[model samples]
Target chain A: MNRFIARNGPAYAFLLPWFLGFFLLALGPILASLYLSFTRYDMVAEPRWVGFDNYVYMFTRDRRFWKALNVTFTYVALAVPARLIMALVVAMLLDKGLRTIGVYRAIFYLPSLLGSSIAIAILWRQLFAADGVVNRVLADFGIPSHAWITDPNTSIYTLVLLAMWQFGSPMLIFLAGLRSIPRDLYEAAEIDGTPKWRQFLRITLPLLAPVIFFNLVLQTIEAFKTFSSAFIISNGSGAPADSLLFYTVYLFNEAFKFFRMGYASALAWVLLIIIAVFTGIAFLTSKYWVHYENERD
Target chain B: MVEMTRRKLLGTAAAGVAASALVGVPALAATRIRHYWWGNPERDKRTFAVIDLFQKANPGIEVSGETIGWGDYWTKMATQTAGRNMADLVQMDYRYLFEYVRRGALKPLDEYIGKSLMIQDFDKGPIDGGRVDGKLYALNIGANSQVMVYNTRVFQEAGVDADLINWTWDDFAKACEKISAKSGGKVKGADDLALMIEVFESWVRQNGREFYDANGKVAATVDDVATFWQFWADLRKKDVVRSKDKTVILDVPIAESGIAVGDTAMSQFWSNQLVGIQAVSKDKIGAAMVPHKAGGKPGQYIKPSMFMSLSRDVKDPASAIAYMNAWVNDPAITKVLGLERGIPVSQKIRDQLAPGLSEVEKLSINYFTAIQNKVGGLPLPAPKGAGEVRDAFMRTGSDVVLARTSVKDAAASFIDDAQAIIDRAQ
Candidate 1:
């Protein structure tokens, strides 16, 4: 015991604070919520055990649950690609080796830094409002204006647009990945009289596949967990025909507003499984396309 | 010095933490209690002033006030309730009173009445509004009812001088149509009131029925709600009310609504909200009774705007109850907090605050006074999971206005969905 303590004591001490936080704050609640998923806990009263009832109802009868799933899935499908493409395009633009690259990177990165904040979400709501700045700008070109944020058919698209606008994080990653690619390969392609588009298709696309896969999986999970902007824009009730009812937003309402903590726990677990499945699919499919420089041919 | 071992070091740190926590608890023998409330900036200011007054009056008691916006209040309270660390004095709403009381989160105030809590002069109606299951769990701080607050300038410009007091639904619709036509579509006649469950309840009560039956089921049929949505849908088609896109921003403060922004001439809200609306609006605002059905009952009822209750885990019930008593019955506190929460329920406080009210407050008071005797009895408290039901109603109503679904289908789905929410909550 003395020898063990002497060998690992300092390292364990260094990790004690995080260990305390994990055990007391994170792990305890995580396990408790897992147990709560099988019960009916309203926060105020005792949790009543009703095994699988919350899950059964969530799967079979909850219309809002289905609606939330539909909205979140649609958002993930649209937002993930839209954001990645925007990020890659911007990263390519910034990769031109300009003298003011640092300044431009900072400027482009500002939106993502501010993206998930309540102030930015509120600003997005105002920007897409009926008589807001977006409409005013559209009016200057004689384009008829529409309420982009509140219209049921168009509201989720506004959130997607917000996601595309805040492509700073992935853009930085892509910029790093682009910088690491060998310039000699591109020069050799140029020497062969390869067209710019074909070079992009053959070399740049294949080389960036690993980075793209990484960003795709990360952004897809982030898209599925979207809450703050959707909650703010939809007034926290998933308004305008439940078009903005993201899964996390619906889970929040079920837990906090309605106090159905147990049901919300079940919903949360289902969301976790959905994200895991998508990530798994992405990983399994990536083997065919993604290549690493260190990997054997 | 002894060489420090891991166990000894951990024991010393634990002892240090325990000592610090113990030192933090007692502050010169003065009783410390927390008072929590949810309101806007104006109400927060008024509430803090009252808290200061209470602290000043009782030097032995130290009161700290915790204020949050309305949206976050319930969530915070639920979390605190779960942790069993709720504030000593909790500001509650009528919709949540039954839920909190049923869950054993509130202390029954009946034992403190006429002792530490003074309410001998209070009226029975407001008092009863705070009772759940025959026990007084909270004290009503203010009483208010629904009313139509209009921009007088827009009304005059549109030449809409219909008898707002005795007007029927048809009269309101005609006036709205005229307002839109006269404005040449520059301004909508009204913000959408169709999604307001309070207005729907009023309509139900006007037809000589309560919104909820004795068994806690919704008494209004799907057809009744369908008709209500159809009325608003026709108005949407005529462009009298704001469109679904403009009207669905329900989370914004009342001061940001269309009527306050001059995009609409009128809006339906509680009487107490008139001061807030008028404060932000440029036009001269006036209040009137909500338009009832022709030859039907007057459905408006004075509602307890909010309540102050002692949490079950209160550390100092005497201090907490005293603060609640002062909140309602004290003239000094009422003078500063006049009509900010709602109209004060105490007769003496109302008499004291009458001359000191601002012009907008006077307008609210006048409308409230005129409609006091004419209103019907208070409706039953909302069922559990009413917050979800209200959201479902608004979603269905918005669907009808957006023309995403027929009114009949939306109403049917809303009824089925809301009932299921209520049943699940049970």
Candidate 2:
């Protein structure tokens, strides 16, 4: 026991700062938010216990809440699948032993690295503006261009494209997963006269299932928590009649703009629950499709 | 192996030192005041100079200046104030003064005034604007009023007369049409209908029906707001004014405004924005009185451009108040800041800064001085949910213009949303 402790003591000591940060910074605020969800805290005055009022109001009276939820889910529905498919396809392309694959990987990973940054969000806003590069291209094609960010019908699509463009991180993870599958598996399938499409469908996809599941869970959580792009592109209030009002953005407005801290806390907790439920569903549903070589034990 | 061990020891020692340092420091050593404001580059330069002056004036005081664009300023202020970590001294706007005061975020200046500060003679309207329920929560830094800014070159090209002081909305529309026709659509007359709201609010106030009642209730009727929107709708249909691009509404620093930058021939803006407009457009830009209804009251008021307020949580209220007094009352600082924050409220500062001003600043100052005697009261204190109300207006207005909802329905919906926001806030 002493030898074991001596061997691992430095490692445990090194992790102490992160653990402390987790408990004090992350966990403390999270717990405070949980407590605040049950009370009225407008920041100016002391908190007053008003159990379930904020949650009740959010679920019942707040149309903005419902609108935000719908927008967020719509975004997740469109963004998550589109992003995963794009990442997977790109990862496969990169894995094909092409020349300058390192450069290709870096180029593909750049947007994801830059994702969630304010500068990139600003760029996204400008790229989709009325006379932006996208619209300028459309204009050159003799098409009448409407204000993409300002138009309610097309604003969400612009965000979807923004989200889809940041598929780099997932692509890198997929590439790693692709690399891990032994070459002998493909060699065996090929020697058995299996076609390229069948080999990909049977071997490549099944092996990549775990990675796909992981990316889906992560991307969905990220999509739900998205705020910067929507906030920046819409100039802090989801523009054109709340078309771009995502859940987190609405929560921000409630907390900061309206000073409804209790309500925002409630919204945050509800969002956590939603994310938890989605993740739980993903895990539960993964058993049928996900092929794990290590599961036999 | 010796080198690796030495390096590892050094790393461990460094980590230990850092950990100990973090644990040992209970509070920051220096007394640092985090000051925040919103302004353009010119204002930023002058503000930093003033900060340097203030630091030199009081050697013991160390101030850290933080600035953001105007659009993000209020949001950051609200968040920080709510979190009880507001800056010691904050540059505030009139729209948020009442809300901040009511929330007890701003320190009342009654005690600090007359002792630590020397405010010159100004009208009771502006002075009272900083007060709520008999407590002076902020100090007026400067004031401005709404005015019509026209491209003189465009007017000349269109053969329209230079004087537009007594021009009615009908006359304004006719002039816009003429300008558009004459310019062959290379220059639009006006950008959008949102500008009409400022005129409507002023008009309504002059008519004894304010946007919000004295009781902080929505006083304007559905028909009142409908008629306001209808005026613009009619003008838009007449091809006199172009509809605002949706994306442009999201952009700030209105000096980038299509009208102010010469994409459109005319615009309505606060008198303070004339300097910024001039900077953007090198061509001839001129000011005129906001066109009023036939035989109607002038309805215009010298709006309190912004205010400087001390935080309630400030450790040293006297020092903060002194700094604010210097910024507002001192002629030297005012000269540096110029009309960037608007015209100075102090007569001494105004006189001192007026002589060396550029042609554009002089024009704005002269135009404002010409109407200062006839101007009405400043706009009323915006209610707690005023931001939401403005957003609701913009949203519903967009809906109406986009034909997603009828004007009447949009107006009614806006009233409903505005009322709900007010009630929720209450």
Candidate 3:
């Protein structure tokens, strides 16, 4: 035992702080929230065990629960593809062209860094308000300005535009992927007199599948967890007829605003499951399309 | 060598114990008090200034002050309460007073009343506003009521007089129409308040009823609310008030709202917010009673803006009470404070600050005192889950304006759903 301890002592000491925090700070609250999910716990009082009551109420009676789920799913479905495709297109544009693309890349990459911050969210609200810059620009074009952010039908679309605006990180990753593609294959296709579009369809698409899959999984999860932008935009009440009621926003309101911590815990677990199922599906489907360059096909 | 080392170790042990005892006992003797609140920069400035004065007055005590912005305050406060580490003094909202008191996070100040509180000159109405379950748990910092705030410059541009004291709903609508036509579409007449709690309370009160009934159900009849909704909707149709896109940002806060930006000439808000809005626009803003029915019991209730209470974790009640005494009853501090919080609760301080008030402060004091007898009792303390119900009001109101739901149906459904939410609290 002494010999084993001596061998592993340095590693153990290195991990000691993180191990302590994990168990004490993280694991403790995780288990506590799990227990509370089965109880009727308000912040004000002791949690009374009412096993599965919160889940039951959520599945059976809560219309807003259903609405929140619908909004989140719609957001994920819209934001993920739009953002990734935008990244890929811009990456392609810079991969073969633009001598000073580094400057442009840095400029483009700035939005993703600030995308989820409260300040950016607030700025987005002002930019899309009725008298804001977007409408003013539209008015100059003689297209007639509309209430883009306030209209329930178009509010979610404005959020999608915000997500799409932050395509920088993904574009960087895509550029790296593009650069790594062997030039010999493209040269051989060119020698064979293949059309540019044909070469792109046959080779580039297949080669870039793995990166696309990676981005799809990552962005989908990130989209599901969106909170700050919607919260700031809607003033935390999911107003304009609850059109901005993202699942996380609703969960936050339940936990903090209404102090129904138990119900919020239940909602949180449901979000975890939803994200897991989508991620699992992406991984399961990757075998069909995502191929590594190292494969000996 | 062994004998010398053992003697030295024993000597150090004795000294350490003595030092610890000396250090710990004085902690008990220090009379240190911790206070916490959430407010703007000016409020923090005035509060610290008063603390400086108090510290100078009593050199024996040490006080610590902490401030947080309003957006994050409640979350931090709840965490502190749950941890049983709340500050000795708490700045609480009237909407949240019952919640804190019910949770036993607040200390009942009845025993210290008239002694530490020095409420001898305090009015009964605002004081009674802080009681829960027949126990005086806290004291209000001041009183306020809902009123219409207007920009006097805009009123002149629209060729309208500044007085709206005895105006009816119809009169308000006509003014909006006239102001809209006169401005040549530059400024809206007034911002919509359809989604606000103050507006709902005032409207129901004007109809000779209250917003919440005896059973704590929403008492504003469906027809009454529908009529008001229809009024705002018709105004929207006429472009008198804001249209759909602009209405989306309706009456957010005084500083950020359309009124501050000169898009609207007037807005309905609590009298407590007078200083904030006036400071925002740097324009001459006027306060008038919310337009009532032409002839009925005036339905403007003077209510407490906020209450200050003792936390359950207080170390020294006397020191905390001393701070509270100076906060409410001291004339020098209240005069410095002016109407930042609201009308001063103490009669002596109110009379003292009266002559020294600016034109804006005088507007609030005169309007509140004028409407003192006209309004009904403060609506029943909103029940638990009241936050959810209040949010529902906004959602339903928006649905009506967006024409997603008929006004009558929306009103009926909202009333039923709101009542059900309140019932769920039981």
Residue B357 accuracy (lDDT) in model 3: 88
- Give a tens-digit lDDT track for model 3, residues B1-426: 999999999999999999999988857636889889888877888888888888888787787899997767887888887778899999988878887888889998989877766886688878888899898888799888888888788788788763577777878888788788999877888887677766776777778887777777777788877887888888887888866665654336557666788888778788977887888886788887787777765677778887888999999999999988888877777877889888877788888888888877888888887777666778777767677787788788888878888889998988888887787665
**Number of the predicted model whose lDDT against the real structure is largest:** 1
Query: How much of the true A–B contact set does each candidate keep?
Result: 0.93, 0.60, 0.57
Q: What is candidate 1's lDDT per residue for A1-297, written digit by digit as tens?
A: 999999999999999999999998899778888999999999999999999999999989887889999999999999999999999999999999999999999999999999999999989988988888999999999999998877888999999999999999999999999998899999999999999999889998889999999899899999999999999888887877788989999999889988889999999899989999999999999999999878986
In model 2, which regions exceed 4 Å deviation? A1-18, A191-193, B1-34, B57-61, B195-197, B246-248
Question: Per-residue alpha-carbon lDDT of model 2 for B90-173, expressed as tens digits?
Answer: 988888888778778888888766788776365566777788889888788778889888888888889887357667777887
- Local error of candidate 3 at residue A87 (angstroms): 1.6
**Model 3 alpha-carbon miss at residue B72, Å:** 3.5
**How much lDDT does candidate 2 score?**
0.81
Model 3 quality (TM-score): 0.90
Q: Which pairs of residues have clashing backbones in candidate 1?
A: none
* lDDT of model number 1: 0.88
Q: Chain B alone, TM-score of each model?
A: 0.93, 0.90, 0.89
TM-scores, in order shown? Answer: 0.93, 0.91, 0.90
Docking class of 1: medium
Q: What is the DockQ of each candidate?
A: 0.73, 0.49, 0.46
State each model's C-alpha RMSD to the native: 3.8, 3.7, 5.3
